[model samples]
Target: MTAEPAVVAPVLPAALRERIVAEFPKYPEKRAVLLSALHFVQDTFEGWIPQAVVPEVAALLGLKPIDVWEVIHFYAMFNSEPVGRCHLRVCTNLSCCLRGARGIMRRLEETLAVRPGEVTPDGNFSVGEVECLGSCGTAPVIQVNNERYREGLSEDDLPGLLDELRTRLAEQDAAKDEE
Candidate 1:
């Protein structure tokens, strides 16, 4: 007979723990804390909040296991697995499509060498064809992390934009690692 090794579970860091607890008091109900926990996990994982974490987050919030899972699945931002650290959600709906979004998508895919929903091998970026981001005026826009880079982006302009994003993210990671 072969012996099996015990598996260890991952936990949120202590500082994050305290922050969550401190804010728990602010919400009227325990379930209300779900969004905050998801946000914490999102930032902690450098953006992707996986479904595997649902149970842990549920437990922390004193809610049923399915509660966290529901929210995670409902929200497009929460990923079921690891994704590229720099997520680019391109608007592929009507307005964006009319504004050359197809060209922008092709260029981003060609430049990153990855299709939507797949991350680059370097883990630097991921692309997603999203629904309207409420930016018809800025059709053909992309949401990267918290910043939205817009204004009729074209295939020719993609590489430089990606390069700039990579540089900015490199600086961000460097700064975080320094702390």
Candidate 2:
């Protein structure tokens, strides 16, 4: 039988490596910095953790590949594949569910024409269900890009919220293009 060809791993950028290294002192050990390193890499890669980078992160942290993989798979905040420019995570736990979260989610699916865990055709937006955004008082919340939380949403709010997000992203893109 013929021998198998070697698989090439993607290179982590110097700046990103530096950033990860910078996080080292904040944590007690390199292993403790894994989450932050994963975040830096994910943000660098535009919102998802590519599988090829897992080994790189493991090597950087002096941990096993499985160690990195475990954390990546365990966290809902981490995406293992490509996502849209805006990922809308709607809270679906009991508190939010009782407060019309499902309706809001359905509206998002219909409006975006993509079901949960799928990206829009233009690659601009995606929707997914998440548990306990910790805003039960403001149930029916949507976390935008895993950064900002939009709380107290009714089904009536989806259209405007989506439009606002689209406009904001477009403006940000325009600014980047000018730069």
The candidate scoring highest on TM-score is 2
How well is each residue in 34-76 modelled by candidate 2, as lDDT tens digits?
8889889878887999888888889899999999998999998
Candidate 1 lDDT, 13-126, residue by residue in tens: 787767677787787887787787788888887787765666677878898878777788898877767778788888899998998998888888887899877889989898
In the predicted model 1, the residue pairs found to clash are none
The candidate that wins on lDDT is 2
Clashes of each: 0, 0
> Where is model 1 poorest over a 10-residue stretch in terms of lDDT?
145-154
- Show where candidate 1 strays beyond 4 Å: 1-10, 50-52, 149-151, 172-179
lDDT of each: 0.80, 0.89
Q: List the RMSD of every prediction in angstroms.
A: 3.8, 2.8
Superposed on all Cα atoms, model 2 deviates from the true structure by an RMSD in Å of 2.8
User: What lDDT is reached at residue 132 by model 1?
Assistant: 85
Give lDDT for model 1. Answer: 0.80
